[model samples]
Target: SDTLTDQQKKCVAPNVYSLAQAYLNSEQAWPRAIYLGETPIGFIMLDIDPEDIDKKENAYYLWRFMIARDYQGKGYGKKALDLIIDKCKEDQKSVLYTSCDMEEEMPYRFYMNYGFTDTGVFDDDEKVLKLQLI
Candidate 1:
Protein backbone atom coordinates (compact mmCIF):
# COMPACT_ATOMS: atom_id res chain seq x y z
CA SER A 1 0.00 0.00 0.00
CA ASP A 2 2.92 2.31 0.58
CA THR A 3 3.73 2.08 -3.10
CA LEU A 4 0.30 3.36 -4.08
CA THR A 5 -0.38 7.03 -4.48
CA ASP A 6 -3.48 8.60 -2.91
CA GLN A 7 -5.38 8.40 -6.22
CA GLN A 8 -4.44 4.80 -6.72
CA LYS A 9 -5.66 3.95 -3.26
CA LYS A 10 -9.07 5.39 -4.09
CA CYS A 11 -9.36 3.35 -7.27
CA VAL A 12 -8.74 0.14 -5.32
CA ALA A 13 -11.00 1.32 -2.49
CA PRO A 14 -11.88 -0.37 0.82
CA ASN A 15 -10.57 -3.78 -0.10
CA VAL A 16 -6.98 -2.57 -0.13
CA TYR A 17 -6.06 -3.50 3.41
CA SER A 18 -8.27 -6.57 3.57
CA LEU A 19 -6.97 -7.90 0.29
CA ALA A 20 -3.39 -7.31 1.28
CA GLN A 21 -3.90 -9.11 4.56
CA ALA A 22 -5.71 -11.98 2.85
CA TYR A 23 -3.04 -12.26 0.19
CA LEU A 24 -0.36 -12.42 2.82
CA ASN A 25 -2.17 -15.29 4.42
CA SER A 26 -2.62 -17.37 1.32
CA GLU A 27 0.21 -19.78 0.64
CA GLN A 28 -1.41 -21.28 -2.44
CA ALA A 29 -1.38 -18.01 -4.36
CA TRP A 30 2.41 -17.61 -3.98
CA PRO A 31 2.68 -13.86 -4.05
CA ARG A 32 6.09 -12.27 -4.45
CA ALA A 33 7.45 -8.90 -3.50
CA ILE A 34 9.52 -7.05 -6.07
CA TYR A 35 12.33 -4.76 -5.06
CA LEU A 36 14.42 -2.20 -6.86
CA GLY A 37 17.77 -2.95 -5.27
CA GLU A 38 17.03 -2.67 -1.54
CA THR A 39 13.79 -0.71 -1.74
CA PRO A 40 10.58 -2.73 -1.97
CA ILE A 41 8.90 -1.76 -5.23
CA GLY A 42 5.86 -3.93 -5.94
CA PHE A 43 4.04 -7.22 -5.62
CA ILE A 44 3.21 -9.99 -8.06
CA MET A 45 0.65 -12.66 -7.40
CA LEU A 46 0.92 -16.00 -9.20
CA ASP A 47 -1.66 -18.74 -8.99
CA ILE A 48 -1.98 -22.22 -10.43
CA ASP A 49 -5.36 -23.90 -10.83
CA PRO A 50 -5.77 -26.80 -8.51
CA GLU A 51 -7.63 -29.00 -11.00
CA ASP A 52 -5.05 -28.50 -13.70
CA ILE A 53 -2.22 -29.37 -11.36
CA ASP A 54 -2.91 -33.11 -11.46
CA LYS A 55 -2.51 -33.16 -15.23
CA LYS A 56 0.47 -30.80 -15.14
CA GLU A 57 -1.28 -28.56 -17.65
CA ASN A 58 -1.83 -25.43 -15.64
CA ALA A 59 -1.23 -21.92 -16.80
CA TYR A 60 0.53 -19.67 -14.33
CA TYR A 61 -1.54 -16.50 -14.04
CA LEU A 62 -0.39 -13.17 -12.74
CA TRP A 63 -3.28 -12.08 -10.51
CA ARG A 64 -1.96 -8.69 -9.49
CA PHE A 65 1.07 -6.59 -10.38
CA MET A 66 2.05 -3.03 -9.72
CA ILE A 67 5.23 -1.00 -9.67
CA ALA A 68 5.34 2.36 -7.93
CA ARG A 69 4.91 5.33 -10.28
CA ASP A 70 8.43 6.42 -9.46
CA TYR A 71 9.64 3.01 -10.59
CA GLN A 72 7.59 2.81 -13.79
CA GLY A 73 10.32 3.56 -16.32
CA LYS A 74 14.09 3.04 -16.14
CA GLY A 75 13.88 -0.73 -16.92
CA TYR A 76 12.25 -1.83 -13.67
CA GLY A 77 9.20 -3.32 -15.38
CA LYS A 78 11.37 -5.57 -17.52
CA LYS A 79 13.42 -6.71 -14.58
CA ALA A 80 10.24 -7.43 -12.61
CA LEU A 81 8.82 -9.40 -15.54
CA ASP A 82 11.99 -11.42 -15.81
CA LEU A 83 11.55 -12.29 -12.17
CA ILE A 84 8.04 -13.54 -12.94
CA ILE A 85 9.36 -15.76 -15.73
CA ASP A 86 12.04 -17.19 -13.50
CA LYS A 87 9.55 -17.87 -10.72
CA CYS A 88 7.05 -19.51 -13.06
CA LYS A 89 9.72 -21.63 -14.69
CA GLU A 90 10.90 -22.76 -11.29
CA ASP A 91 7.33 -23.85 -10.53
CA GLN A 92 7.32 -25.96 -13.72
CA LYS A 93 4.38 -24.17 -15.24
CA SER A 94 3.66 -25.05 -18.88
CA VAL A 95 2.58 -21.52 -19.75
CA LEU A 96 1.90 -18.09 -18.34
CA TYR A 97 -0.84 -15.57 -19.11
CA THR A 98 -1.54 -11.91 -18.38
CA SER A 99 -3.77 -9.15 -19.67
CA CYS A 100 -2.86 -5.56 -20.38
CA ASP A 101 -4.87 -2.52 -21.36
CA MET A 102 -4.38 -1.57 -24.99
CA GLU A 103 -3.59 1.97 -23.97
CA GLU A 104 -0.70 0.83 -21.82
CA GLU A 105 1.83 0.18 -24.53
CA MET A 106 4.69 -0.54 -22.16
CA PRO A 107 3.18 -3.65 -20.61
CA TYR A 108 2.08 -4.97 -24.00
CA ARG A 109 5.54 -4.49 -25.40
CA PHE A 110 7.10 -5.87 -22.27
CA TYR A 111 5.13 -9.08 -22.64
CA MET A 112 5.96 -9.27 -26.32
CA ASN A 113 9.64 -8.67 -25.73
CA TYR A 114 9.58 -11.52 -23.25
CA GLY A 115 8.14 -13.84 -25.94
CA PHE A 116 4.48 -13.68 -24.90
CA THR A 117 1.96 -13.80 -27.77
CA ASP A 118 -1.55 -12.43 -27.85
CA THR A 119 -3.84 -15.36 -27.25
CA GLY A 120 -7.10 -13.67 -26.32
CA VAL A 121 -8.77 -10.34 -25.91
CA PHE A 122 -11.60 -9.23 -23.66
CA ASP A 123 -14.05 -6.37 -24.36
CA ASP A 124 -11.91 -5.26 -27.30
CA ASP A 125 -10.01 -2.98 -24.96
CA GLU A 126 -7.43 -5.34 -23.45
CA LYS A 127 -5.16 -8.05 -24.76
CA VAL A 128 -4.24 -11.36 -23.21
CA LEU A 129 -0.70 -12.51 -23.77
CA LYS A 130 0.51 -16.05 -23.36
CA LEU A 131 3.98 -17.51 -23.12
CA GLN A 132 4.34 -21.23 -23.50
CA LEU A 133 7.06 -22.59 -21.26
CA ILE A 134 7.25 -25.92 -23.03
Candidate 2:
Protein backbone atom coordinates (compact mmCIF):
# COMPACT_ATOMS: atom_id res chain seq x y z
CA SER A 1 0.00 0.00 0.00
CA ASP A 2 1.17 3.49 -0.78
CA THR A 3 2.03 5.91 2.00
CA LEU A 4 -0.50 8.70 2.41
CA THR A 5 0.63 12.30 2.15
CA ASP A 6 -0.36 14.59 5.00
CA GLN A 7 -3.09 16.10 2.87
CA GLN A 8 -4.44 12.73 1.83
CA LYS A 9 -4.45 11.61 5.45
CA LYS A 10 -6.86 14.45 6.13
CA CYS A 11 -9.36 12.86 3.79
CA VAL A 12 -9.06 9.25 4.88
CA ALA A 13 -9.95 8.60 8.47
CA PRO A 14 -7.39 7.15 10.87
CA ASN A 15 -4.48 7.23 8.37
CA VAL A 16 -2.30 4.24 7.50
CA TYR A 17 -0.01 4.61 10.50
CA SER A 18 -2.91 4.62 12.90
CA LEU A 19 -4.49 1.63 11.21
CA ALA A 20 -1.20 -0.26 11.43
CA GLN A 21 -0.94 0.54 15.11
CA ALA A 22 -4.50 -0.60 15.70
CA TYR A 23 -3.84 -3.87 13.87
CA LEU A 24 -0.79 -4.45 16.03
CA ASN A 25 -2.56 -3.57 19.26
CA SER A 26 -6.03 -5.03 18.84
CA GLU A 27 -6.95 -8.67 18.54
CA GLN A 28 -10.20 -7.79 16.83
CA ALA A 29 -8.69 -5.71 14.04
CA TRP A 30 -7.02 -7.01 10.94
CA PRO A 31 -5.39 -5.13 8.08
CA ARG A 32 -4.83 -6.21 4.51
CA ALA A 33 -3.03 -4.73 1.55
CA ILE A 34 -4.91 -4.16 -1.67
CA TYR A 35 -3.06 -5.22 -4.78
CA LEU A 36 -3.54 -5.32 -8.51
CA GLY A 37 -1.55 -8.35 -9.58
CA GLU A 38 1.83 -7.65 -7.97
CA THR A 39 1.44 -3.93 -7.45
CA PRO A 40 0.16 -2.59 -4.15
CA ILE A 41 -2.52 0.05 -4.60
CA GLY A 42 -4.30 0.49 -1.29
CA PHE A 43 -5.08 -0.89 2.15
CA ILE A 44 -8.10 -2.12 4.08
CA MET A 45 -8.75 -2.73 7.71
CA LEU A 46 -11.41 -5.02 9.14
CA ASP A 47 -12.65 -5.18 12.68
CA ILE A 48 -14.95 -7.62 14.45
CA ASP A 49 -16.65 -6.17 17.45
CA PRO A 50 -15.46 -8.14 20.46
CA GLU A 51 -18.75 -7.55 22.23
CA ASP A 52 -20.66 -9.19 19.38
CA ILE A 53 -18.36 -12.21 18.98
CA ASP A 54 -20.70 -14.66 20.71
CA LYS A 55 -23.94 -12.94 19.77
CA LYS A 56 -26.22 -14.38 17.12
CA GLU A 57 -25.75 -11.20 15.10
CA ASN A 58 -22.13 -10.29 14.55
CA ALA A 59 -20.96 -6.91 13.22
CA TYR A 60 -17.91 -6.89 11.03
CA TYR A 61 -16.59 -3.44 10.43
CA LEU A 62 -14.85 -2.05 7.36
CA TRP A 63 -12.69 -0.03 9.66
CA ARG A 64 -10.54 1.74 7.06
CA PHE A 65 -10.11 1.75 3.29
CA MET A 66 -7.96 3.96 1.11
CA ILE A 67 -6.65 3.91 -2.40
CA ALA A 68 -3.49 5.61 -3.51
CA ARG A 69 -4.07 9.10 -4.91
CA ASP A 70 -2.92 8.03 -8.35
CA TYR A 71 -5.07 4.93 -8.11
CA GLN A 72 -8.30 6.70 -7.31
CA GLY A 73 -11.11 6.91 -9.92
CA LYS A 74 -9.81 3.82 -11.70
CA GLY A 75 -12.44 1.39 -10.24
CA TYR A 76 -9.94 -0.25 -7.92
CA GLY A 77 -11.77 0.90 -4.84
CA LYS A 78 -15.03 -0.67 -5.96
CA LYS A 79 -13.41 -3.95 -6.90
CA ALA A 80 -11.48 -4.07 -3.65
CA LEU A 81 -14.66 -3.46 -1.69
CA ASP A 82 -16.44 -6.24 -3.54
CA LEU A 83 -13.67 -8.63 -2.59
CA ILE A 84 -13.92 -7.52 1.03
CA ILE A 85 -17.66 -8.14 1.00
CA ASP A 86 -17.08 -11.60 -0.36
CA LYS A 87 -14.67 -12.36 2.46
CA CYS A 88 -17.21 -11.11 5.00
CA LYS A 89 -19.87 -13.35 3.51
CA GLU A 90 -17.53 -16.36 3.72
CA ASP A 91 -17.07 -15.57 7.39
CA GLN A 92 -20.85 -15.78 7.94
CA LYS A 93 -21.16 -12.28 9.23
CA SER A 94 -24.66 -10.86 9.15
CA VAL A 95 -23.64 -7.32 8.30
CA LEU A 96 -20.66 -5.07 7.61
CA TYR A 97 -20.36 -1.74 9.35
CA THR A 98 -18.35 1.38 8.52
CA SER A 99 -18.21 5.06 9.30
CA CYS A 100 -17.17 8.07 7.23
CA ASP A 101 -16.74 11.76 7.66
CA MET A 102 -19.98 13.42 6.61
CA GLU A 103 -17.96 16.13 4.97
CA GLU A 104 -16.04 13.81 2.66
CA GLU A 105 -18.20 13.48 -0.42
CA MET A 106 -16.23 10.87 -2.35
CA PRO A 107 -16.05 8.19 0.37
CA TYR A 108 -19.59 8.87 1.59
CA ARG A 109 -20.97 8.42 -1.91
CA PHE A 110 -18.74 5.47 -2.67
CA TYR A 111 -19.96 3.43 0.31
CA MET A 112 -23.60 4.33 -0.36
CA ASN A 113 -23.33 3.31 -4.00
CA TYR A 114 -21.84 0.00 -2.86
CA GLY A 115 -25.02 -0.70 -0.75
CA PHE A 116 -24.13 0.61 2.67
CA THR A 117 -27.09 2.41 4.19
CA ASP A 118 -27.03 5.02 6.86
CA THR A 119 -27.64 3.44 10.27
CA GLY A 120 -28.53 6.69 12.02
CA VAL A 121 -25.61 6.10 14.30
CA PHE A 122 -22.70 8.42 14.91
CA ASP A 123 -19.27 7.53 16.22
CA ASP A 124 -17.91 10.85 17.38
CA ASP A 125 -18.32 12.96 14.22
CA GLU A 126 -18.40 10.13 11.71
CA LYS A 127 -21.68 8.85 10.24
CA VAL A 128 -22.17 5.14 10.61
CA LEU A 129 -23.38 2.98 7.74
CA LYS A 130 -24.06 -0.73 7.43
CA LEU A 131 -24.44 -3.26 4.63
CA GLN A 132 -26.59 -6.27 5.38
CA LEU A 133 -25.26 -9.58 4.09
CA ILE A 134 -28.00 -11.82 5.39
lDDT of 2 by residue, 1-134 (tens): 24665656766665557576675758877788889899988888888664533466576888778988888889999999999888888888888888887764767898899899998978878888889899
The clash count for each model shown is 0, 0
- Per-residue lDDT value at 62 in model 2: 82
For this target, which candidate reaches the highest TM-score against the unseen true structure?
A: 2
lDDT of 1 by residue, 91-125 (tens): 77788877676653656776788798987666345
Maximum-lDDT candidate: 2
- After superposing candidate 2, which stretches have Cα over 4 Å from the reference? 1-8, 13-16, 50-54
lDDT of each: 0.66, 0.79
Question: What is the TM-score of each predicted model, taking all chains together?
Answer: 0.70, 0.83
Judge candidate 1 at residue 9 and give its lDDT: 47
Task: Return model 2's CA RMSD, one decimal.
Answer: 2.8
Q: Point out the worst 10-residue segment of candidate 2 by lDDT.
A: 48-57
